[model samples]
Target: MRLLSFVAVFLFSFSLAEVGFAEENGSSVSEERLTPEELDYLVNEVGNTQEESEDLPVEVSRRLIEEEAQVIDSGSGFMVIYDPEVTKPGQISTFASIAATTLKLGGTVYKVKSDRSKDDKFYIYGNFQWLKTPSYTLVDKMTIGFPSSSGLYLPTSGGKVKQHQHRYSQDQQGNGRWIDYTIKYSPSNWEPSAGVAGSYDIRASTSKTKHKGYIGQYVYVPTSKNGKINIKITYGHRRIAGTPSVSVYPAGLSITPTTATDTRSYALTLSY
Candidate 1:
């Protein structure tokens, strides 16, 4: 994607070898605090996928990063913010993908909503649904992804997706209706620690009526180098039905701001 392109060009121009891969066995100590409930939730319902390294081939990683992290053309002197929010009752908000454009001054935080009618599921990040049945409790699936940087910080609110279901039973007025099945939520332990190239992968299953949900969030962290460097973000999510989820391995490229005292233009940095 755009971000991957940015990193590729930045890395190629500077001739910096791509960095090392994060170990599969949960290399980074997550600063995100897990609640007893969340701990039990993860341990009992979901397997710790981050601890097992998938060993994405070097060429595959490079190609996937470039193919998925598309760059946005925000023009010169513009800061492109690639952010997305997911919402629903009982589930954590997540950015299935991101949006980008020039940064607005005094508006460092950007907000965008999900539009199901537009097939804008990218904004939703992962697949979520609430199905009904006669004999069984409804089965709901939850997936979450985390970045590989400590500097990232996600706010408690913002991305929200509401859900509704139709019930055949009639109200006092004798009319069938759509019931609000919106799942209320709080943030989870989703933050990244410093200098880790690996992300968190979480998934869980619960009864549809259990009032349990997952919210995945993403926030950008700023980094700098003496010279030009490619800021490649390694993001991961849970694979569903053996099909690879896009958020499971999303990559992007970014350019760190240059200092005023560092008069060397980015082109010059390429030579050094």
Candidate 2:
């Protein structure tokens, strides 16, 4: 069988699925803060899987800067909670696998509902009702590549803590379902105490779900005319930002703009 290129409309199914995964076979339809009963209801029910599809690798899983930790299981797939602080909201998780191996074999994926208007609200989903695709159908086109990332920033030695402006572009297409691009910039962090200057550029992108994504990367290699010359260079950094705000390792540096400055040019500064 071939992979189903499109997914179906997810509606009432979420409620049944959520309850099936919830505690003690319970279903809470009202919108209210979880009481002790509800808390118990949720914690017990969330991320419950079907006892099948337990072995797919997580292609990309990005924990938001201000995201609540979630639980994952073969029956329920993936779940997302909430964070009280550091608020810049987006998806909770993103998961991808070979179409043939996952839903076809016995796995599911869950996406957070954007339109469902309730605080701490989410929905649980499942896939592959008729067993559309098989694992052995497409071995000839198989290739292995790990997702990666590259990042750049302002020169730490410039004493430029000022927030800068920048521009960006993206495109998500084909099976990849992501927007890819190249970025050039200075280091986001500066060590005044040691006077160690650093700068890096990043090329990154994401899919519609944005979690458990992949990045292709190449690092900056510094060139030296003479070993004695102390010149601040625009080299690349291997560590890339996991989200829109900061990188996986932020040493007082932020690559993304807190806000866009000029819409046309798409530029940024060190100090905002």
Candidate 3:
């Protein structure tokens, strides 16, 4: 006749104190320490659930006990597990709960910060540690100034094309002239798919153009004379990924008269 055994496991919540001992050779023992709350949650919740299981074979019951002990021993304070899918600020708290549960189950959790801004924040609970994502600048904001002239001068030496400002006629009633400009990006020995290559914003007169996605050749017409073009370019890196360098080169510009025989001159300056 087969023998059936019922396993009764009792879990008591208590503070886990730091314990250290020396081996026979005098080597110190190092182990992960769990907070009181984490220990209480793990034992009262996880252990009690397992204890409620009904009778099973003696071997199966023994195996289950061993497995539970192994799960409790696997947690580490030094190691972190990163989940890149959790990238948004709204998902931080929800993910933190999942991370805490994972930690209780002898798993690891990594703290991650959103890339939106320095002021944007999130927290990881199980580890009870704060981690900050390092900031890196891929492209510095630069401004190109031009003297008042009737013609636009486009640069001949720049990398792949990213943006283009076409020469277009403005309203005859306005004193503005069209300035043709181009923006290009060149990666420094890195794949373009590694991270965001770059982004740019162009502000001229009363108009503002922002580019956050897609790097491609495009034309824009901003009517301005003796006005400034404010340009700011930024690059973002993937979570936990090291900094990658890139260059944003504002190519030269081409000038065209708004109207035939219109000799009105204007100075165009670009700043970020």
Give lDDT tens digits, candidate 1, residues 96-181.
Answer: 53333222111001112322232111111211112211121222223233223323333333553222111111011222222222
Question: How would you encode candidate 3's per-residue C-alpha lDDT over 1-272 as one tens digit per residue?
Answer: 12222221111111111111222111222133344554454445334223222211122223333333212111212223232333456554344433311101111111122233422211101111112111211221111212223122221235432222111111111322222122234312211211112222222222122111112111112224223332122222222223333432332221122221111111222321
User: Residue 61 CA error for candidate 3 (Å)?
Assistant: 72
Comparing 2 and 3 on TM-score, the stronger one: 2
Give TM-scores for every candidate, taking all chains together and pairing residue i with residue i: 0.22, 0.16, 0.16
- Compared with the true structure, what per-residue lDDT tens digits does model 2 show for residues 155-199? 223455322211111222224232222221222333321111122
Runs of candidate 3 with Cα error greater than 4 angstroms are: 1-94, 97-131, 134-154, 158-225, 239-272
Output the lDDT of residue 132, model 1. Answer: 18
lDDT of every model, 2 decimals: 0.24, 0.22, 0.23
Cα RMSD (angstroms) for every candidate in the order listed? 25.1, 24.1, 29.9
What's the C-alpha lDDT at position 6 in model 3?
21
Q: Model 1 Cα displacement at 221 (Å)?
A: 3.2
Off by over 4 Å in 2: 1-174, 192-272
Instruction: Output the better candidate (1/2) by TM-score.
Output: 1
